[model samples]
Target: MDQHIAEAIGRPDLIHLDERLVCLRFETMKVVSALAAVRHLLDTGAVRRGDTLLDSSSGIYAYALALACHRYGMRCHIVGSTTVDRTLRTQLAVLGATLEQMEPCSDLKLDQKRRVERIHEILLHHPEYHWMRQYHDDIHYLGYRTVADRILRAVGTRSLTVVGGVGSGASTGALARHLRTAGPGADDVELVGVQPYGSVTFGAEHVTDPEIIIAGIGSSIPFGNVTHELYDTLHWVSFDAALVGSVDLLRRHAVFAGLSTGAAYLAARHERARSPERTVLFVAADTGHRYADTVHARHEEAADITGLAPQEVSDLSELALPWSRMHWNRAPAPAPAPRA
Candidate 1:
């Protein structure tokens, strides 16, 4: 009954993992945003069907945008990060998307910066290309409204906690915003965002994780769309902790999800333990196939999930270690990092 593949894959499967824990799993989560964003653009005359839509992506958004372009009869051009794995690159190519990938770069911030710079450079040559600013634009939030409605219908907003990685702020931020405005128990929904130690979004850039900075969940630069006030709490999860969570998720619940989902799951479990009265639902943004070699392969190295607990911190200055949790208290965005 779906009009397109994006519509089919964009629809998530809500799995009740436990009595109070739920998993909203998506094959490719950003398809929801890309589809709706493109539709809105077309409807509003912001872009036409044959136009080339461009954006910078680490991985997921490239595929999402490509699929959206394919569905809407548009061209997709992605300024890909160094992290754009071969799997995603091939998928994007097969879907008729042009990928301008960056050279090998170990530094996440530099890689992202280079991609953004390249996007601008391309725009200079091709002014006709419409740049889909996934990190900065609010148009990405419009798609999640339908997702919020589905969640509200399945699980009422009463004593609910929405947990997910704080990517571009479009996912968790939009979900919490739409759910809060839905009805009577609107205020009951709490948003708990998961972040990486290197992400500057919540002032975590000061702390560096020895392991890989889980891409997609965190950003080294400031994200314009991230409304810091939407989050009630924040969890900074390291790659090692998330590895355990991802392995445990597949081992226990059989949900094969990406690294970010693992991080969100780790935080969601903590929230559920702290508030048994509240139902915790975490977003599993994508499948585990992409992470099979990177994360899931080293299952032996993963610490026991049962023994892992985040160090609670009252302030960002107190943040430390493999895991840390802080009550953001709907605070304003932190000051942006000084550019070199």
Candidate 2:
């Protein structure tokens, strides 16, 4: 009876990827956010005892919410995305969260719409159930203060650039926003938002399916929190690019992280190569255990992943060049963090 599972959440050990790049392996980041959201509800009497907490998630948030509710003695129900798999189902069951999955759909936007619709239906039937509007709610942003503070502590005030998927606008946006004012390196932190090819967030056409193998990173739907201003530059990663990065991550660092992590890793490499002396940090959003079936490629040859994104493109497939990258602003003055 450890009774401290929540303690394990979000206290990730940072790993060095290169001289100037690091990975914050935040597999449990969602747990931190979920707990913060739920605890706020309970503390403010937003929802009373026995009230079911409901939300939609395709991946880590589902398990994260389940873990939060289980520890807090609150009943939880989840409307999971169509892409959620059997592995997550088993994990959710063990965590005691009730789940109603949407009908499987390939289109990302449609799948998101259907999940929201299902959530509305569930709300209509059970009005008492508290819906944690994770995407749009500012409460989702509170948990990352701890994350930003940790980075500031580990690496003193410096001009650090943070990169990661811009899904709900919660993780990368929230964390970067927090760091700007409070992080030790708050002076000139640049945020680079990452999205898969074809995501509507960065104004790319949805005619072709998004190359996002994992859900929750890129949404075809509008994300109210994902502000364009937050990210100075945007990188649109393709499935092939993410797969390439993921393979290299496993073979090189043995990180075993997800597609989102791979995308961040790729962006970090690109940034690091562009300016070797600057501190570039990225989020390893989750571990890759859930992506074992499709995203990994044991057969691919490994290389020390370097900058691939030469320029942003309208058609990710048409480029047929390398991974896409764009500079949204002039490179800020570099200030390296103190060494351990």
Off by over 4 Å in 2: 1-3, 183-185, 206-214, 301-307, 312-322, 329-340
Q: How high is the lDDT of residue 173 in model 1?
A: 98
| Per-residue lDDT of candidate 1, residues 141-219 (tens digit) | 9999999999999998999999999999999999999999999879889999999998999998888899889999889
lDDT of 2 by residue, 1-340 (tens): 4465875865677888678888989766688788788888889999876779999888788888888888889898998887778988998988888999988787767888988998999889989889898887878887888888888888643768888888888888888888888834475888887777555666544324344534667766666666667777777677767777888888788889888888788888887777776799988888888776677754254344563555655433443323566654533311322234
The true-versus-predicted C-alpha distance at residue 12 of model 2, in Å, is 1.5
Query: Lowest lDDT 10-mer window, candidate 2?
Result: 330-339
Q: Candidate 2: lDDT of 149?
A: 86
Top candidate on TM-score is: 1
In the predicted model 2, the residue pairs found to clash are: 157-184, 309-323
Single out the weakest 10-residue window by summed lDDT for candidate 1: 331-340
The list of candidate 1 runs beyond 4 A from truth reads 337-340
